[model samples]
Target: MAATLFPDNPDFIKRPPFETDELRRCLTNYLDTPFEFDPSGARPLVGNYRWGVYAFFDYDDEPIYVGQTNEQLRTRIRRHLTNQRTDAVAMSVLDPFEVHDIEVWPLPQFQDVDPKKDRTAAMAARLHLDALERRITAQAITNSQFKAILNEKDPPPGELTVEVPPSTRGCIVSDRVREIRGHPDFRIARRALIMSRLAQVISERQVKGGLRRVMLTQAKRLEWLAARRFEATGGARTVPQEGDQDGEE
Candidate 1:
C-alpha cells in the first residue's frame, strides 16, 4: 500500500522518523531561553550537567578513602552516606556535616590518543586533579593542620602560613583555597586553581618587566595567611592586626 503524502506541509519533504509539532515547539522554547554558563559558579556542563568524580580522604576513617564517579554528586554522596547502595564505601568517616566542606574539581575531558584535538585543556584538568589529591593526601599525612582552609570555620584575619616539606616539588600554593571555599560549585575548584596559576605567571612576568600591576599578588599572600590563622583558632574570628583592614584595600 502506498502512503498518502501531505504535499502542502513544509516538513513533509524530508520528515524525521519521530518528528512532531509538539517536539518542535518544545525544542524551540529551550533554544529561545538563554542559559547562564559559569563553570565556577554553577555545575559543570558535562556529565549530564554535573562533574563526574568526587575524591576525598575520610578524616575519621583512619586510612579509608573515597573516590567515586557519578552523573550527580549530591545524589551519589547522599547514597553513600545512607548506605543506599551495597557497593558504597562504608560510612565510617566523620559525620556528614563535618565533611560538608567539599572541594570539587571538574574534568570536562579525559586523556585521549587523538592527535588533532588540543590536549591543553585535558592536561590542565589532570594537573589540577593530581595536585588536589596530593594536597589532600599530604594534609592527611601531616594531620588536620594541613587540611583545606575551607574546612575551617570562621577563618582567621591575618597572614596565613603553610609549611611545605623539602621533598615536595613543583607545588604552588595560592589563594585558590579561599576562592574555592567561597565558591558553591565543586567543579570550579580546578578552574580556580588553573586561573590562580596563570595569575601567578602573569604576576611574575609583570615583576620581571618592572611594570606595576594590581594587588592580586599581595591579596593572595594575605589570604593564605588569613586561612592559616583561621585554622589555628578552630575557625574562630580573630582581631585584625595593625595592617589588616578586614580584607579592605
Candidate 2:
C-alpha cells in the first residue's frame, strides 16, 4: 500500500482549499494510496500539523467563508458544523449540499522545550485566521457587485449631507486636526479630518496651492495610518459621524 502525502495517515481527511489541476493530482494520489492509521498516539512523525486553513463553499462552489485553526483540522470543522456564531451553519442550511475544503499547512516544528517558537507559531495561526477571514469576505470582489445589487433593489435617494456638530464647531481647526492625527488609526481618521478640514478651509475662503500641498502631505500620512489599521484590524471600520444614528445616510 502506498503512503499518504499528508503528515497524518489516510484516515485524516482534509479538503483542498481550491480546485486546481495541481490539487486534483494531489487528491488523486492521496485516494490511490491504501489507508493506514498511526499506531502510536503521538504527533505526526515527519511534519508539523500545528496550523491549517479551510474554506466553506456553497452548492455552487462559491466560497462563503475561510478560517484557520491550530488544533486538529477535523475537530475545527466539526465545531463549525455545530456553531452558530458564524454564517457556516446558515450557509450549510441554505445549500444542504455545501462542501467544505481544508488545506493543512505545516508550520515550523517546535519542541516541547521551545516555548518562544510555539508562541510564534500560535501568533502565525491567529494571523492566518485573520487573513483567511479577509479573503473569504471577498471585499474586493463583492464591492461592485453589492453596489449593483443595491442599485437594482433600491435606487439612490440623493446626496448624503451630514450636519456639523455645533459643540465642536468653535474648536480651533488646528486643534481638531491635531486630535484626529493622534489617533491610532490616524490615516483614515486623518483623511476624514482633512476632508472636514478642506470643508473648513473652503468655508473660511482659504483655499490655495499651499492648502492643497498640505492636504497631499496629510494624505500620505493617512495612507500610512490606513496600512497600520489594516495590519491591526485586518480592515477599516467606517467612522461614525454626527446624525449617523438617525439613518441620515
| Number of the top-ranking candidate, with TM-score as the measure | 2
lDDT tens readout by residue for model 1, 3-92: 345566655556532323323333233223322343245533221322233433322222223343324444554454333362222211
Show where candidate 1 strays beyond 4 Å.
1-66, 83-94, 110-132, 139-143, 146-249
Where does candidate 2 have its weakest 10-residue lDDT segment? Answer: 164-173
* Top-scoring candidate (lDDT): 2
Q: Each model's TM-score, in the order given? A: 0.26, 0.29
Cand. 1 TM to true fold = 0.26
Off by over 4 Å in 2: 1-48, 82-96, 100-121, 136-249
What's the distance in Å from true for residue 183, model 1? 27
Q: 1-249, model 2: which lDDT tens digit per residue? A: 334565566456465323233334432332233212223344452112334444443212233344555664445544554333433333222111123222232232222223345676565445544454344334322632221110001111333322211110011113233343335654365355544555455467655454454344344444655666667764535546577676532
In order, what lDDT does every prediction score? 0.34, 0.37
How high is the lDDT of residue 237 in model 2?
57
Task: At residue 135, give the lDDT of candidate 1.
Answer: 51
